[model samples]
Target chain A: MRKIGFSVIYFVLVSVIFILNYTFEHTAMVSYSFWNITRAVLLIFAVIVFPLLNRRIYSIAVTVLKEELRKKTLYVIFIFVALLVSLIHVFGKIAPANQHVFVGEMGLSGITLFGLLFGVFMSSTAMYKEMEKKTVYVLLSYPVSRQEIVMGKFIGNMISILLFSFLLSLIFVVSLLVRFGPINSVIVYSCFALMLEFVVIVAIATTTSTMLSSTSNIVFVIIIFLLGHMTEKITHIASRLEAQRLKEAAEVFVRVLPDFKRFEFKDALSLGTVIEPSVIIASLSYALFYSAVALIIGMLIFRRREVDRL
Target chain B: MDHVIEIKGLRKVYRDFWYRPKVIAIDRLDMEVKKGEIFGFLGPNGSGKTTALKLMLGLIFPTSGKIRILGKVPTDVRIKEQIGYMPEESYLYGFLNADETLDFYGKLNGIPRARRKERIEKVLDIVGLKHARKRRLSDYSKGMSRRISLAQVLLKDPDLVLLDEPTIGLDPVVSREVKDVILGLKSEGKTVVLSSHLLSEVQTVCDKIAILCEGKLIKEGNVDELLTVNGETEIVASGLKQEDISRIKDVISSSGGKFISSGHPKETLEGLFIKSIKEKQESKSN
Candidate 1:
C-alpha cells in the first residue's frame, strides 16, 4: 500500500512539469501532444492503485520476503525488470518511420509488459513455495487471518516490483529528457494509460494464483491478457458465427472479458492529443472496478483454501 | 483460570485431485491445555497429530468443530498477538540473519525497540544460538535455522507457545538444551504445546500426553497415571539363567504383573550424549 501511495505521488511529478510547460508555451487548448503526459500519469497511477484493489500480488510477495531480506531472487527480479525495460526501449528505437510512436507511449507499454509478468510470477509462487517448504505452517499457527497472510505476501512483492518499475521508469524518463529536452505533456499521459492497464493485468494474475498452480496461473493470466485486447473482435466474430446460440455465448464472454481496448490511450498520445479529464477519470474508474471484482473472486477462493497445504 | 486452548469435536477433511476419497486428516478431536502446562501430542505418521495442532493454531479452520485459544476464536487477530509458534519446518526469510529475523517478528507483535533488543538477546541465549546471531539464515545449517526459528517464537514472550516437531533436526546436545528451555518456560507458567514422534522426548518433558492414531484419539492422560496403569511391570535378576527366563515370565504373571520383554539394559545414544552434556553443564555451574 505504501508503494502504491508513493507510485501515485511519483506519477503526478510529470503532470506538474506539464502544467509548468503549458504556462510558458501559451497553448490555446490542451494540445494533442498533451495526451503523452496524461498517459504517463495514468500508467504510474494504475500501478500504485492496482495493488490495493487486488491484494493477492502484494500479499504474496510480502509473505515470501517479509522475514528474510537476503533472498537473492528479489535482486535477480530487479535485474530482470531492468533488462526488460532496456530491451523494450531498444525495440522502440528500431521501429519503422511509419510506426514512429512517442517514447513515453513506448515506455508505458514496456512497464505494463514487465510489471504484469513479474506480478504473476511472484504471486503464483508465493504461497506455493511456503507450502512446499513447510514454512507456511508456521504462520498458519498464528491467530492471524489468512487474509493478513495473503495480503502480507502481496504487499511485500508489490513493493519490490514497484521499486523495479520505478527505477526503470526513472531511467527511461531521464533518457527521454536528455534526448528530447524535457518530455512534453504527451509522454506523461501515455505513461498514465500504461500504468492503469498494468494494474488490471496484475489483478488478474493475482486472483488466478490463489487457486491455480504457479505455472498454470501464469499461463491463465497471459491468456486473459491476450483475450482482453480482442473482446471487440470476439464480439464481431460472434455476430457472424453460424450458430446463434454460440454467438450468444460469445457475446456474454465479450461482456465479461476486460475491455483492454478501452485502456488504449496510445492513439491519442501518437497525435500528441490532450485527453479530456473525463476520459482519465473514466479510465481510473474502470481500472478500480476490474480490480475490485478480481480481488473479491480471489478472496473467496482463498477463504476456502486449506491452510495445511499452504 | 483461562484455558489457553480448548477444542470441541475438531475435524479436517482434505480434498485433492490425486486422492479419490477426501482425506480425513482429523476426526472428532476434543482436548484442552491449561494456562501453564507442558502438553505433548504424540502420534506416528498419518496419525493426524499435525492436523490437530494446525486446527488448534487456527492455521486452518476445522471442517465441523469449534476451537478457542485464549478465550477467543483461533483466527482472532487479538489472540495471535499473544501466541508464538514454531512449525516443524522453518519458514524464516533466508536473507536476514538470525538477529534481524527476530527483530522483524518482535516488531510485528508491537514489542518496543529497547525491549525487543533485550528480548532478542535473551531468547537467542535460551535457544543457545547467541553465537550464530550474525549469520544469515541462508548460511545456517538446518539445525541452526530451526534454532533461530525457535528463538523467533520465544522473542515475543507470548502467553502461549505451540511447537511442532521442535527438535526434529537438532543434535543430541542441542535437543537437550531445548528440553531445558521447555522446562524453563514451564517454570514461568507459560503454556507450551509440543508435538513430536519420539516417545522418550515427551516422556522426559511432558506433564500430560495425548496419543493419536489414524485421525482418532487412542489415549490421553497424565504421564504418571498412564504409565502406572498401562506400563509393563519389569523384574531385574542379576544372576538369572537362560531357562529361568520362562519361569520368570510365569512368576511375574502369577504375581499379577505383565512381563513384556527381557533385555540387557543399555543407555541409548541420545541418552548418553544428553547425560554427558548435562554433566559438563553441571560442572560449569559448580
Candidate 2:
C-alpha cells in the first residue's frame, strides 16, 4: 500500500543519484546536485523537527535508555566489544605489515560487525519484550501517541548506540593516534559511516519488530544488511542479463533496495584511502531518508495493531 | 442525566493474521454510564467483558459502530486526558519502582514536577504502598502490583476511570479497599467503570450493573432495581414462636400482600472475614 509508493520514490532517487554520480565522474558536472540538496533538506529536518518532536518523546526515550542500561545488555555487549578489540592488538603481534595498520583494520572491522549486532539485537528485542510483557498497554494508556512511542524507542536506541559507538571509537582512535601519530580522517569517517549504518539498521529492525517475531526480525535485518553492501555486484549482475525484461526488473530491485555500499567506508578505512565528501553526503541523505520512511511505516502498522493481550 | 460513556451498536470481530475470523468478541451491543456512578460490568468466562473494556479504552478498535467517552470518540487523544485505564494484567514496567513508574506516567501526562510529586505521594498513601515505594514492581506481591496500578490510574485524577478486573487476584482485604476507593471516587463526582467475575464483591459497590453473555448484553439496570423481588416482602424477626410466625403469615394474606419465605440472613463472607479478624485481635490482646 503506502510502502509501494515509498519504494518507487526511493528507487527513482537512487537511480538518479547513480546517473548523476556517473556523469559527474566522467564529465565537468558540479559536485552539488540533487543528492546533496536532499541531504541538506533531510539534515535540516533532523535538526529542526526532531527536537520539537522530542519534547513529547523525551520522557519515553529517557525511560527506554534507562531500561537498556539496567539490563545486562550494555555491560555484556560493550565489554565484549572492548575486550575483543583489545585482543586485536595481540593479533597485530603475529601478522604485521606495520602492526598499527593491521590493528586498525581488524579493530575497525570488529566495530562494524559488533556495532550492527548491538543495534539489531537491542531494537528487535525491546519491542518484543514490551509487547510480550504487555507493558505497552500501560505505556499506551498514557496520552502519548503511537508515533511518539515508535520514535521514542528509535531515539532511545540511537542515543544508546551513539554512546556505545563513542566509547568504541575512542578506544580505536586513541590506539591509532598513539601508533600512527595523530587522529586520521579515516578513523573519523569510518565511525561516522558505521553510525549511519546503525541508523538504517536500527530503523529497519524496529520497523520489522512491529510485525515479525524478534528471531525473524534479527535474521531479516541481517540479510538486508548483507544484501545492502552488495548493491554494486547485484547491479552489475543485473546489467549483464541477456533477457531484457528480467534485467529491467532486476535493475528495479537494485534501485529500490538501499545502497549500503556507499557507506562502505571500511574498505577505504583499511586501505587508508580518502572517502569522497559526495559519497558521505549521499549516504547521510539515504540514512535519514530511509530511517524516516521506515519509522513512518512502523507508526502506521502499530497504530492499527491491537495491544490487548487476548 | 449526562452520560459519561456511551456505546451505540458496538461490534468487535477479531480475526487471525491470515484474515480468517477467529471470534466475534463483541456482537452488536449498546450501553451507557451516567456520571458519578460505579458501573459493574459482569459476565461469564468468555463473555467478552475484557474485550468490551479494551474497546472502550481504545486499546482495540471496534469492527463496527462507535464508542464515546465523555462526548468524544474513544481514540481521541484529548479525551484520554480525562480518562484513566487499568487493564486486566498489571502491564507495568518491572524495571521501575513505584516512584519511577508513577513519575514516568506523570511526565507523560504533562504534569509538572512539584504537582507530580504531590500527587505521587497522595496516590501512594491512598493505595497503602508508601512503605514499598522504592522497591521495583517486579519484586512486589500480586496485591502490591494491583495497588500500584490503581495508584497510576488515580495519579492524574481522571474524571472517568476504566478498571478491568481490578480485583482479579487480590486478597479479600485489598479487594475491599479497592471497592472503598471506587465509592470514594463517586463521592468526588468521577465515573468509575469496572469489570469482574466476582459478582458478590461487585454487588456491594456497583450503582449500576450490566451482565453480558456471549458478546451480547443480557441485562442492565440500577443495582437495587434489577435485584429487587417485586410484589413480595420478607420479614425478619428474632424470638418468634411457631404460632407467632403463623399469625404474621395470616396478617400478610389479609393485607393482600405476598409473603416470601425467609430465614435468618447469613453474614457476607467479607463481613465474616472482618469479624473473625477483629475477634482474633481482641483475644490476642486479652
State the displacement of the C-alpha of residue A276, model 1, in Å, after optimal TM-score superposition. 3.7
Model 2 CA deviation exceeding 4 Å by range: A1-53, A276-281, B236-250, B253-262, B278-286
Fraction of real interface contacts that model 2 preserves = 0.71
TM-score of 2: 0.89
Location of the lowest summed lDDT over 10 successive residues in candidate 1 chain B: B228-237
Which ranges of candidate 1 are over 4 A from the true structure?
A1-109, A182-184, A239-251, B16-20, B229-271, B275-286
- Which lDDT tens digits does candidate 1 get at residues A138-231? 6554433455455456456546555666777776666666555755565555555556666676666666766777788778877887899888
Task: Tell me the deviation in Å of residue B113 in model 1.
Answer: 3.5
- State which docking tier applies to candidate 2: medium
Among these predictions, the greatest TM-score belongs to: 2
